[model samples]
Target: MGKYEQLAKDIIKNVGGKENVLSLTHCVTRLRFQLKDEGKANTDVLKNMDGVVTVMQTAGQYQVVIGNHVPDVFKDVCEVAGISGGEGSGEKVKRKFSEAALDIISGIFMPSIGILCASGILKGVNIILDMAGLIPAASGLGQILAGAADAMFWFFPIILGFNAFKKLGGNPYLGMTLGAALCYPALQGVNLNVLGFNVNATYTSTMLPILVMSFIAVPMEKWLNKVVPDVVKTFVVPAVVLFVCVPVGFCLIGPAANEVGAIINNVIQGAYGFSPIVAGILLGFLWQLLVMVGCHVLVVLPMMMGLMAGEPQPLMAVVAFPSFVQTGAVFAIWLKSKNKKLKTIALPAWISGIFGVTEPAIYGVTLPNGKQFILTCVGAGVIGGLSVLLGVSQFTMGGMGVFALPAMIDPANGSGSIISAVIVAVAAIVIGFIIAFVTYKDKKEAVIENKEEKLVKGREVICSPLNGNVLPLSEAKDDAFAQGLLGNGVAIDPADGKVVSPVDGTVMTLFPTKHAIGLVSDNGAEILIHLGMDTVKLDGKYFEAHVKQGDKVKKGDVLVTCDVEAIKAEGYSMITPVIVTNTADYLDVVEMASGTVKAGDDIISCLN
Candidate 1:
């Protein structure tokens, strides 16, 4: 098979086929997919598949974590799915929903974070062991663990170089070669100095510059790989380019780039040094927003530098607030909401937040609705500002969260700073909760009154078409839906059954297996209900229908019915989804309480 053909097949198989995919997007480390049916995408199948390291469904996307070559994988997925790979607009999709995605984001960073903590503990142990004259610095287990722990930093360039190359859709090993050149032994010994002063140059554990360069290099590699002809190009072009490019990069590019990074770091440190309080507030509000854009990595480079330099960086002191505040804000929403589905997601987000992964809380909960995000930010900023002014500090480098408390206590500086940080964070949560509570008007009262007064015309909102659970559409696993790539609506927890309209509307279309149904509401809003994951395996056996395409459905109308228990027996979730396909056309899509909803129930109401 042709290389392109093989690549296409690999992407298709992991994504659950052309039909299962909703959309695809890419970031530094992942190819994010929003799928029509997440269950249809076989995790085990994808895991065992070649070129795949792990499949992570996080932040409401089925992320095929193909290690560093995720960009290539993403390109292949786009090719196979016949979709264009564009700088995706941050639009929201309405057809997908996910609980696992949120959980993964909130939890995925834990293992790495735990290892980081373990390494810190070991470093401290080594310090004590040496001070007490017990073991030498060359102790085997200690040295080995230290190396393992520090490897991510020591060789960040090489790792990211390989990753960036793959992401740009090129020869991954070639990318590694480029990274190796950056850290070459010959280059290490070379130096550029000014006025007899040794220029500070250490790439051993530096971040950002090399990785940034890799982004440029990977695309170059791909272009070179494709345009260069086979005959003498392989040996001649590569060898010549290596000889020329490596020197140019180190002699000219590397020094300038490294200096720029240093300048940025110094500027930030200077800002913090000027007024730690201001730094705390500014970073607390903006740090998460930067994280969303992937620019937060730039900020982190400086923090890593501070750890290496053994200095107190104000950013580190305030870093834990945003993560904690997101969890707090989400917890408040979960408690305030009557939605059982929200509770399920919020609970996991809360737990994950304690471990320092806030992606889930940020993407799945905070950003979806504008207000809560603002509240969380304000809360985090207030807390962070107070933390800095109060002289909070972290002695060790660790993930930011509850588990990170140990590292925050500097034995030399004492534990006062750690206590102050927690106090500030908790206070911020309380204030944020109050803000959120005040902002959340009694929508329930409005819903109850509308029902009692029959204000809901024949236009009663429909239940989710599928039967697993009702969830926020923003949390969909499919990218087309998660990033709002598709038009507005909500996602259903798909389970087998006849899909009913949530409102009095014309039937748009029913999918072949009766696994999905589409409708146009009286308001001209589009909606879809997709059934259980891979329940397609049933091949319409357990599916039943009362209406055909174009049939009219009133609120609470009997649209379809299936043996819910049988669907469960097949290992599918009974959770159902109710969607509003054209939510953008309206001012707001007011979802009903997020629990066991019934047909003809007011699933969502719209405002113009």
Candidate 2:
């Protein structure tokens, strides 16, 4: 069995089983599921499951956050659930128009994003090497590399056709055949008189025409399948699809789609040309927000159409710095935070953001803090507007972050644009860092406690595990704890780092990180003590365990010791939560301590 087989099975079971799934797709860190009925999924169980990060329902996609290794889990899920081609055997549930459009766009493009970005990077590098005079454009090595870099874009119609047809539930090879015919060399600039109608258009590097052709071909192929004999159906359907699609595409779709693309490009360029700075500021400020909601791809489609039609994209250039802006904010957090766990997440997120992947930085650090995310957007807007004022624009699609700078180098315009790009990126990072560092504040919880009550008979008394001020679990920064999703509990702003046993019990689980421990009391009470919020990311740093899993322990026995000052210095909150994981197993769990607590003082009473 695969490593994620069991996890995949569990996910399938909780997500209303395989029968409820309409389709499944994935991007980077999430498994996007389109379900027949969203209400049937067990969201809470999936959230608390091991190996899962979180779950989200947005844009008509039930998203399962599975971290970076989501692809592996997605594969295992498909295998275990008998899901072929990521589509389930059921009629798709009707979705809102906007949601359906977003799903269709994502399905068509997401599968190709990685290769597209890699190709863009290669093209950018080739341009740099040629400009440097190290590899002249006419040199054999340069020509070979140029071909490799340009092939994907030059033949993009065929690629788009294959993906589009597959997404629409049609045969992909037929789509490819139609796309190939459109790009045939003899057809370029050819004027054909078919019933006194002139059909002349160049289809190389085009997008919209093939997309239209694929949509038309699916229904045509379906109609042919019904009339054709079974023995010759395969060959006849494909033959008919190609013959009909190619001419219709060239005669009608190609010319019309080209004009439509031109109109859209002209409008965008006109608006951008009217006030470059305002356009820049607006795009930069809203780009990340659009990305958060998965609507950014809709914006990219028109820009891509324009780029392929030989138009400059100043708007994309302006919005390019948002990732770097996020990087800057994460850097500030890394420098300012004393929490080892947060610092650990921040550093890597910052690094990935620099490489043009900001999901880690956005979801992991900035968005969670709220203020820092806004500061980064403000920084991006300022830099984006400045970039326009300084005359920066992109001539071609390129890789993100630092790798995108090469696209700013307009061979006809000298080095001015590239210089502007560098200035904007550096300024964004510096400004974002300064703004976030000065304005960002760590979360602080107010301490409040109920009046003390004496433990009564037929109840179990659990003592305080650490010296601390009392805090209600409802006020915890973590949603799973604050909402009581993990079970009823109260939190503590620890005055000391020592974690002692609260009852005579056996250690049920000791987390490898040493940041949490679980015990089963002799009186049938289950207790879980978590040392800090997100402290698991610390990976055992500054934590020492005195007892291992399955060890027998009595009340007041020291179970673990943490470096209080060191953890605080690292910027981690030492607000610990002692939860009764099996809260339903008892009558009620009540708080017994008020205001402050010392180890060995009764802090909770589990009523029988």
Candidate 3:
């Protein structure tokens, strides 16, 4: 069996089974599923599953993010379920027209961002080589390599057309055909008289022209699909769709949309003229939100690409601020978190966010706490505004995060954007750290209780905190507990939500969310009882705490009472995890029993 075989099976089961999957496709990090019925799938179960990062619904598709190893997992998932893979079915669902357009644009362009950055890096490398005299720009070797790097951008219309057509549910061939006509060599610099008006347009390396033409090709292809018979559909569809779209494009949409680009550029420049600092701050502050709603790609990414066609794109410099801000906030969570669940998510999220992925941090850690999310914006905005005012510039289009620095390095002037970028990143981290530490205070009793618990010598046996069926920690749903990453533990599917003290101990810490508690036994066993996964979002509405930090209790003493049905009704699980948090302090933490248990029953045996 493959490593992810069970995860694949579980994911398929929760996503309404293999029968519910109409078709499946995967990008670098997510499983894009076109489901027969979106409502039938259990998003909560999928979100809490091990080996899954998070679940997102966007662009009329149910997306299950599987992180960097998604390709291999996608293959096993298809093979296990007898699925014929490739996403296409159920594409007719309607969304708001503007939102639909943004979805189509982002879906097509996001896949190419990796290659776009790679090619830009190569172009930057060539320029550096030429300037340093290590290689001659006029040489044939340099020319071939440079063309290799430059070709992806120069022919973007065709590349974008192929993906865009798939998104719009049109014949991709027809879309590519129209894109090719826009870049036909014979018409490269020609001005044509159409409809008693002269039109001059060339769209080889442009942004708007290709997008406008591709979207227009969508409805035109749909009309032709209905009229053209399947007997000769393959050739006839492409021929008719292109023949109509190409002429109409050059004569009408091209000229009109070309002027629209100029107008948008003018509007953007006018905004920047008022205060470049304010524009930078706004972009940095809202970039993550824009990405969440699927607008950043359509609005900001294209603008930078369009600007890069002629000269340096300064906007690219400010956009990099969000990556650092997001990572910094996660770093703060990692440093400040006492809840092992939060700590586990924070560490991995911080690592990925540094590399320019924010979904995990935003969905799993920061966004759950309103203050944490706002702090990221504050840090990003302050630094982003200062960067623009200091004249930080970028010479090419590329990736985000630390890798984006290559584009900012201008050998010609040595403007120190690289230094400023590093300083800004450090500032963002510091600001984020302060916000988390200040906003979420540590439990006051932890300091007082830890001093006494440390004086005890031997390990202590802990009893069950609830009347429930005992489950191995591996079955906890959440990876932080399931994988034993938060130390040795056991879990429960509680019959009732009454939580009691497992040992004669002091309550070391009580979460503000009222969903978790920490205790240290008199004999020195440090334990954590965490309620349902991600239940902290409830903010204590369904839970009533009978004890506070530093309160003393014996076995079977009720610590809290919760309305379990309220949690379940609100789409959260009722499985509870009981973990020996300070596992390193003992020789070994062992589970004493499994399968069935009652409150005060023996469950965890800690050895000194």
Candidate 4:
């Protein structure tokens, strides 16, 4: 089986099984699901599952945040669930108009975002190379690179039509045919007169025309499917769909949508033309907020439209500074925070933000601490205003963060715009770092016990939770555990089915599946005992918990019991990992036991 196959199966089972899913789609870091009944999902269970970051419900999407590897998980979910093209039949839930619109936009745009970013980066790189005199604009290599960069935008209508039609529950190939007709070379710059009405428009590289066509085609295809006979309906429906949609798109939808797009572009240009700095400040301050709520797509669609029209996009340029700003805030948190757990989250989040992906920074670090997030926004606004004042504008859509600098280099203006971009980026980081470092304060934990009076002093021992042969965590099957992403630990190949408390502490987290338990020792070592690899998929069938969350237990007290033979019969390995989840808080977590052990024996030592 594939690496994520079990994870995918577990996810599908917890989300009310495959029967409850209406559709499944994904973005860079999330699996977006449209469920037939949201109430049926075991949300808490999924949240506690390994490999999952968090769960969110917004804009009618049940979002499973899965980090950067979401695409792989998404694929496995589709395959394991037998989902074809993300389409499933179920009763529709009543939703607000705004919610419905947001859902549709996310469904249509998110699937293609990766390729769009890649193409934009390629275009930006080509421009940078040309400006450096490494390649002339008219050279064969430059021309080839330009074609590769421009292909996605030039054929955007086809891509949009395919996704939009599928999202609307219509035949996608018919949508593609309509988009092709709109983009046909011979039809460009054409004027057609029908019944004394003149239809004149250019449709290549446009979005609205195909979107409108997809909307109209859904109902049209539905009606045709009902009236036409079954055997011939296969060929007939498509033929009729293309025949009607192509003409209506060219004569009516194409001209009207193009006009609307032009009006939107002109209005945005007029607003920026009035006061660029004000526009920049507003976008910079509010952009991350919009992303947090999943509403950024509304702004992105228009910006993409403007870019395809060969217009300079200052709005996108202004918004790009927030990633660096978020990074700066994370750096401050990493440098100043005493909480080891928060520091671990901050460091990776800071690295991700540099690459222009700020979700980790926003969700993992800054937003949880309100002051840093606000400071980051304030820094972004200040830098954004400065960027516009310095005349920084993007001539093409590009990758995020520092990578976006190349797109700001306007060949006609030499390197002046790119220089301004660099200045804005550096200023954003500096301002964000200073503001957050100066203003941010870690919340003081309420002291429950006097540290000096504790028996353990600056050291603690973790007793064996299971009677088993000890194994280094490096030899474990899962990379997350083996590599210590979940924290440093040692694994045990269990010889018994029972789990005992290794320390005197309260239960910190107890998974609904009974396959994992988290404990916080009185001496402050946070430990996690995961029952087995991929055992969460058993859904509590072969496991039982002796204690609930928040229960206090002494060392050697029974915490959980497992049906070892039954779990193994079902193909799950019974190797449990006893991890110090907050390993960074201590100087070292030294494995003390080697070959075999009894439940009450000391297995590891935590030194402070």
Candidate 5:
């Protein structure tokens, strides 16, 4: 009942009052949900909701992109909705076969990636030290540090088991027990007989073994839960499960998983061996496009890890630097835009993209602008292919380009991988920058406001745009206007049909019919002054435009003059809705005065 309680409740209500939510989990920046009905979500309201960056339905999961503080929000969301805040994984979501496969891989492996990345980074640090002769690999200190760094992968099944169990809604320790059984130290030794079966294969640091083990073990755990009595469940579940699952796991599951692993390893190795350049080009170019079409950034996770059983990973190398391409595109828009809204989204998104967060850039900037996104993709593809040609490859999982530099460094040899990565990143950034900067012509376009740009801070006092009797937006006959979808502000029954500027700023848009004018204030709020319901039908018959698009105007300056009597005689609604098109940017929009006033009378309070 604190900071995020209300927000959580609002989110739940809008997501179909918790009934529609089949499962819930969260990643670093997203609230990933498996919903019973995707259609039930009030996506518009959630997207407009404060604290939410955007709403996305991707890879068969509904993702609410909430940067940084998702964990806290996710906890509140679970508590408020009375659903398991399970690590957003393992639900049987409805999706295409490929997407379903990717979803399962991501959902199961995602929660444990933090451990993998941490271990990888630690190992990378040791690599730097060990290679530089700062620490001898055989020394006691080196051994301890190496153990600390390598533990995650050395006994990966255990870590994966814990996360996968939580994801599958089973007792996590049991999953750990199963993992330990697969990677049991004794099993790694020469021929070991377990339960009259000769166990030969060792399952260490491989993906398929633990997955196959769980494919059998998790379901077994679920079956056990149903049949086992409550009184004996405590001792019986583990006692019987470990007894049966362990030996069967060693004899059956482990061997099958190894075979699958070998097949996948061969396939990936063969592909890279065939052509790294082509693979890199395809991955780099399509990665952002995939993201645009609802593929999560981690969609290539399985491919990267699966390939890691043997081959050097080109997936990460090709994909990492391309983010700079998106950053570059947004930066271009920021530099070129005259409209405050586009500039605002672009500037922040561009800054965030440099540090390896591209959602802001993709969702906020490029994706909306067709040409700009295409240019960014072109730059990324060229740079990405060039990176592979320069021998840029990732040795371990890490963040985007600069952040992934350490991971890119070869652990076995002090190779110039990081050097190559740096060059690739720089090239990508430069290429993307040039492409986006030159390709995007802002001459006439810069003046147009980004339709999706929300209102800015300030502009709290909105003076009446016309001499009119103020009314709520509900007075409008049109559903979109009355529902405040266009924005929040009061409708007015005009005393005089002269529409004046509500805020001192540039007129960003003037509709051809002269029925509406969009303005950007000095402070940044976007105001849309719609003359009246269906006024466009009059086709300038009863309306006279006083300002052209892109004209800078002050408050009280006449925007358009209309004849109320003439419009009424023509059958158009006389109620003019003076709406702030980006009202979602503000905390509240209050009607300050309902009855009467002259133009420039502050009638609405746009609270922040």
Candidate 6:
């Protein structure tokens, strides 16, 4: 089997098997799974497994922090375990506030982000054409492109309806139909012109009304599906549902919701008018946090509606700061990290950030590391607040990106809001650099533990048996290591003539070649110690052992020590692998007191 595949299986089993999982999802750097029963999970066991950064239960998902390679690991886990659905269940539903927030943010922004980015890029291209005089102000091409760009905003409900429906476990087509009723051409033409007053009742591109309509539609559809008789339920229920839902959705639901949505919008608009800087600071700092909870899209809808009405919404400008700030933060990390692997990841994250794709940056670099992410948010918020004071405004309906900046610029009004956007962008970048620079102390790099050193009772230590550069299991040369088959562990080599027990345990097995040993600790944890890098080539030769399979030993007991220099002279890396063969049962793995020593020192301390 491939390296990662084997490793995935080992980790999966360690986490209490596929049945233990209730649901599974992935962000840029983590595989978020919910367990069927947390009581049965050994998170600490999973955490110490090779290639894992940490394990957290938050926002209803069991998160495995595996960094940029999470998707690959997730896929491997699902395939091996025959997982069909996305979430794993525990005995009861448990809530994780942080994960819930993150999940919400992903839900709200991830769906339409690609569309907005594409539109922004196209808008930029159109601006270029206009600047170069290639497309006249009234050119058909310009109009067509502009119209294409506006289409998504105008019909955002239809798009959101599908996504929201999926999120809520309802049929998307029905949800879409419910949204279409609100913006239907005939319904939009219903205007009130009484007393010689022309008041537009247009609902095109409106956000709040359609969302309100969805709340009703989802429940109404669910009731209908449940109540309808078996045979004719499908046909009869849909027909009846459409007849009842469409009319109500338009007549009472859409308009009333529209009015309510407008009131909320008006309140925000008035507040912003009173203090743009305050609004910008609040919005910029909180926008990403809102995304984490899936409510950010709710904010986007109102802005889209303002765009549809051809009004320059201050909310648009307020949000632009965070989008740019995420990029700045990622760039700072990319420039600062000296690790080649981290540098490789940070580069792509930076590129994605430029296109206004912040998920990769947020998950891959920021959130995992903790401090850099907080700095990004605070630094960006400051820039946004300042931009508000500078009277920066953007007319564009799309989210932040260089392509959207020109659309924000208004030649007719000479608003100079686009310039404000530029200042904020530049300021945010500067702030991010300062924060990251100040925080960029090179922490300890990845290290593998060796098994041939001293061990004390009741102490935690890794017994790595091979020697080579400590590669992350995800990047290991061996298929078993790559797939996490060996558990939360690292590759190491025999540093001396003897291998010793890092914990008090019974020897489970001693391979015939004396190249590998398996032990079960008193705490019921299983460990494997494999000697030498690429020792499979030695076919277990030149290896000797003091202990046999099934012998009970205390911590620091002599197990096996090999000729390290001789092994190296024979062209094998003395790198070893110390692993918890079963890891998925716990909550996390914590590295104990550090500053390095020889073999058999405490390495990974488990937390349940």
- Which candidate has the highest TM-score of all? 4
Report clash pairs, candidate 4.
Answer: none
Q: Which prediction has more favorable lDDT, 4 or 6?
A: 4
lDDT of 4 by residue, 133-159 (tens): 898679999999999988888888988
Worst 10 residues of 5 by lDDT: 443-452
Please give the distance, in angstroms, between residue 550's alpha carbon in candidate 1 and its true position after superposition: 8.2
lDDT of 5 by residue, 122-239 (tens): 7777788888899987889999999997777778888888767776677889889888878878778468776677768877776667777776777877888889999888878888
Q: Give the clash total for candidate 2.
A: 6
> Against the true structure, what is each candidate's TM-score?
0.62, 0.75, 0.70, 0.82, 0.72, 0.65
**Per-residue CA lDDT of candidate 6, range 576-608, in tens?**
666666654433333333233355555555444
Better of 3 and 4 by lDDT: 4
Better of 2 and 3 by lDDT: 2
| lDDT tens digits by residue: candidate 1, 198-246 | 5435565554555555555555555666778877667655565567555
C-alpha-based local distance difference test score of model 4: 0.82
Between candidates 2 and 6, the TM-score winner: 2
Q: Is candidate 3 or candidate 5 better by TM-score?
A: 5
The 0-to-1 C-alpha lDDT of every candidate, in the order given, reads 0.59, 0.80, 0.73, 0.82, 0.74, 0.64
Lowest lDDT 10-residue stretch of candidate 4: 446-455
- By TM-score, rank the candidates, best first: 4, 2, 5, 3, 6, 1
Candidates' RMSD to native: 10.1, 10.2, 10.9, 5.5, 12.4, 8.6
Per-residue lDDT for 496-532 in model 2, tens only? 8888999999998786789888889998888889898
Q: Which predicted model would earn the best lDDT?
A: 4
Prediction 1 global C-alpha lDDT: 0.59
